[model samples]
Target: MKYLEGIAEFCAVADVGNFTGAANKLDTSVAQISRKVASLEKQLGVKLLQRTTRSVSLTEAGTQYFQQVLPALKVLEDAQLAVSALQASPQGLIKLTAPVAFGEAFIAPLLNTFMQKYSGISVQCTFSNEKLDIVEQGLDLAIRIGKLEDSTLVAKKLATRHLFVCGSRDYFKEQGQPRSIEELKEHSLLVGSQPYWRLFIDNKIQSIPVQGRVRYNSGNALCSAAVAGLGIAQLPGFYVRKALASGQLIELFPEYKDKQEAIWAVFPSNRNVAPKIRLLVDFLAQHLVSDS
Candidate 1:
């Protein structure tokens, strides 16, 4: 049992080919995953991975070890799932928070289904854009987007969100389409809390400082402004998807969309995660549409 400690971590890195992906899959921190895998290599006295800034590759010995262990791990995982499926019905009070728009558009509908499935389970939610300390608030979960402030939190990735730059056809016609990033200076930009917009231009990520006519903390409000032909806005796909599809808004510089951000369900690692909470996260991950 002592020697078996890092096998799962090593296996995860091998399958995902990156520590961050393994961390997401295992619902742990990347540092923890890296430590475990490094410990495993030290124990075996073999260099199993060739790690680079951008990629991870297997050594010849690692390939052989992986080929042998992957099937065994699969069997172990299958057995665990088979056993867990027969456990008691998960029921408890679950408290959580998410971005208002996302919670309203996606999480709320799934929650009704979750409550129906677990008759004894009760739910409470707080929808806000401001970040809250879940552990300090004595909350069970926090559904978050983009960078996580606390690196130690245990997080399971739920979905990917795309930020789209768009404006109404009338707005484009009046202002004239921006042929380049520099041309954006010629028109008004609608923005949120940040004055800088994160975008991919010329195949490189850039954070360009912007001066906008209107600034709102709400993505929904910014999206509406874009639809009203007030200005060009950068909004998440969930906020602008329908508008783009309906031709109410046209995607600007489609080839230069902002990088996708992962939507995560995060919890305090110090607390013992109850079955009810685990099941809820699993349900969300399974039901939420995945990009890959």
Candidate 2:
């Protein structure tokens, strides 16, 4: 590290052509800069600078060495400056993952606004329902909905995900509405990923087995099918909020509304969270917690 430290001083003296000039540029004493250059030359077993009372110039070997090492030193300095800039302000690409439906409906738009606010920052999002390893996948953060499993990752709750049983007005008009959990079997069902509907009944959690004509792996797709009057579907509020508001879908068993799980911004359990990731999480929490 000592030898490495002198490289910068040598480069500075070579560039400025004098120890005093290099010292002023680096905010150090001329004697310190001179000693650093001398140490660097002694370590290299070759004189790197020719010094006089009036001026300083590089030896032939110094010129060749400077040409070779200056570019690499410049690269290192640039990297340090980039990191310092990030510490001062949020910037860089945030590699993120989220559930497809939520990502498209909410996170994508939220991130769009965040990027507009901080032009130095950009985001790459992977929308999938699959649970990915945040560390192994090298993702900066993940937006997760539903009960989080026990893990080593750090999670910040953004909001509560409320599950709703919903069906199109047309579907209910044709098949009639379910008055209770037991009556769900009598109606056509649209199931996503899970084959059973989980609900809170009689002050206890119940999982009712449901068979549907259309089964999908995506909540968005199931919500679409339900809106088309295919069947009743269990979906998160974010998926059906607009449909319910537009009178295209009706919420079923409103008294049975269950807090299914929570939405979370999850990241690796690192000692220090990156500023970009922390700021993004806070931004999301600010917008989503109220709506949830």
User: Which candidate wins on TM-score?
Assistant: 1
lDDT of 2 by residue, 220-282 (tens): 789899999999998888788889899999999877777757889887664246667788999
Please give the lDDT score at residue 226 for candidate 1. 93
User: Which lDDT tens digits does candidate 1 get at residues 91-140?
Assistant: 55888998898899899999999999999889988999878766545577
Instruction: List ranges where model 2 is wrong by over 4 Å.
Output: 2-88, 289-292
Q: How accurate is candidate 1 locally (lDDT)?
A: 0.83
Report the Cα lDDT for candidate 2. Answer: 0.82
- Candidate 1's clash total is 0
TM-score of the candidate numbered 1? 0.69
lDDT of 2 at 24: 51
For model 1, the superposed segments whose C-alpha errors exceed 4 Å read: 1-87, 202-204, 290-292
